[model samples]
Target: MRDKLLMAYRSIRERRTRSILTVLGIAVGIAAIVSLMSVGYGMEEAITGELTGYADFIGVFPAKITGTTYVELGSFTDRDLKDVQRIGGIKEFSAMTFDSAEVEYRNKRVPIFFISGDTKELESMYVEPVGLKEGRWLRENDYKGCVIGDRVANDYFDEVVHVNDKLIINGEKFIVVGVFEKASTLYASDIDPYIFLTLRATKEALQTDEINYIMVRVYDIEEAEEIAEEIKEAINDNHGLDDFANAMTMGSMIEMMGDVFNIIRGVLVGIAAIALVVASIGIMNTMLMSVMERTHEIGVMKAIGAKSSDVLSLFLLESSMVSLVGGVVGCVLGAVAAKVISLGAGTALGIEFGAVVKPEVLLGGMVVAMVVGVLAGFYPARKASRMSPVEAVRHE
Candidate 1:
């Protein structure tokens, strides 16, 4: 048995190119599934963490759920904002509006997407209060005053866009009150414009009383998600609004992303199953070909008193060793591919998955590869064991 197994190993090693190609093919499929899922999960986590850093951020939309960036067609009557302020369990809240316009300075013009809204009770809850680069932060009852993005400052408004600098917007004039430190994380809210202003001013300039959205800071920050659920039920009961249940808490979103990743993991595992099956078939074919070509040698061993069980064990051992080597090679290749994708594409695309080869994914891939190798060897090993010595010797 030992001699036969060693012979099988030697024969496969002699054809290293074919064996390596088969393993590489299987590795390619496994790596793709593993890498894509890992990155997706990572991105979701990063965004969730960014969301949670806010003290008590919550968003409310009339037709859509909260935490969504979609803006539906509706005017947020001043009355609606007042009614929301009266809701129970609400520590504080703010109303915000949005618009896009071209900002023109003395000789240059640049487009800026800006959020215009009123100053209200909940500045801390809704915004993290950006660092003021120029004059000062927004003041109470400050109108015709706007904050510029730092990027806007350097490029459009010359070297210094000071507090008193005039900004032309859609031919309307606004005094630059302050500049924000560079913005971070696009996941903040629906308002992604280059300027921030009072809600009343936004209404007057944009010609709409409707705010783009509203944010509510819950009394207990930890219960934000739970309270958001409660808020949904209450709104449904009172407003007779159905499917307007899009309120989301940062914690709840993280939890929901977790569930989604689990489902995605299951799908990736399913794809791995198919790939393993294919690789297993290749191993089986290699083993059977080895059996056919070595039949005469097998017959010689049997005639020399090699038992059928001995013959079977030897063939099985040969295939197992071959599979084991394939598994190791596949694991290395898959990890490399995953890392390359995570670092190369991750950085280039700015998706920023921390690192590639997640421990769970690596362990799972190795286990699947070994199982595929063993299963592929089984039937061919059995066939080699049952051959008749006399017939095999006479055949060729």
Candidate 2:
């Protein structure tokens, strides 16, 4: 076996150019599969982590009312909150209203998405306090102060708005109590380009009592699905219609994201596999050429009482070795490619893209490459083993 491997290695070294090109072809395919699949798995974990960070959290939104646009649809009411509070397994609930306004700072004005809610309740729902770029979050009793998003404080104004700077919004002056550090997430949420104010303050400014949405935290995350259903039914029953409101749980959102990625990964892997098929054909062609070139060598081995199986194994080993080396190189290239992609995307979009390569994915890629090599070399190896010693010796 050692002698056969050495002979195989020597043959590859003899035809260095052809061997290198063929290995590169296989490497391209394996690299595509590895990088794409790694990014897919990494995205799944990143998104799921963000969603579950606010454990057992559910968002309740006003549903389609059939005859009105989404903007004109009925908003969450005080009664809905009362009903949801009565539901079992719910730990706490908070009412929030979302609005957009042109915020004016001295000579500059910028539009911002703002949330009006209980400061204490918002704090409880979040994993941690809004990391401040400047000052601090809203105190429970504060009514005229607001915390600004990172963009609002840093980029939105003509000058950087500092802590204690007063901003005018909707003809109302609000002191900048804090500034969010920066927004980073795959999905757009209240974190980016948003301002937070006390519920009473916004309610007074808007001159309306309607709530835009509600967030509920459940005691047990495992029972979130059932709790969500109960909340939805309760709201619908109170309004006397199924389409009046919609409830979404963290688990369902995560599962939906998982399903979407699974489809994407499947399609990307299929495309990569096509490249592998092309590489497999290249391997077969190379093996056939090698068999023809070494016809006399094969004949001599057979004449010296070497079995056909021995000849076949030698050829198979050579092809498999080529693919194995390609697989290793491909993995390195794939990891570097994944990292480059992640960095570029994160810088451009401000979303975290962690490229994760699992142990199974690495092992699976190499194993698949070896299997393809063995199959590609089979016919050529068989033909070489079956050549007649007399004919092969007489031929040029």
Winner by lDDT: 2
| Residue-by-residue lDDT tens digits, candidate 2, 155-177 | 78789888999999878888998
Tell me each candidate's TM-score. 0.76, 0.87
Indicate the TM-score of model 1: 0.76
Question: Which one is best on TM-score?
Answer: 2
- Each model's lDDT: 0.67, 0.82
Model 2's alpha-carbon lDDT is 0.82
Model 1, span 219-330: residue lDDT tens: 8887787767765665555555665434666566667666776777678767766776777787788878878988987888788998988888787777677666666666
Residue 283 in candidate 1, Cα distance off native in Å = 2.5
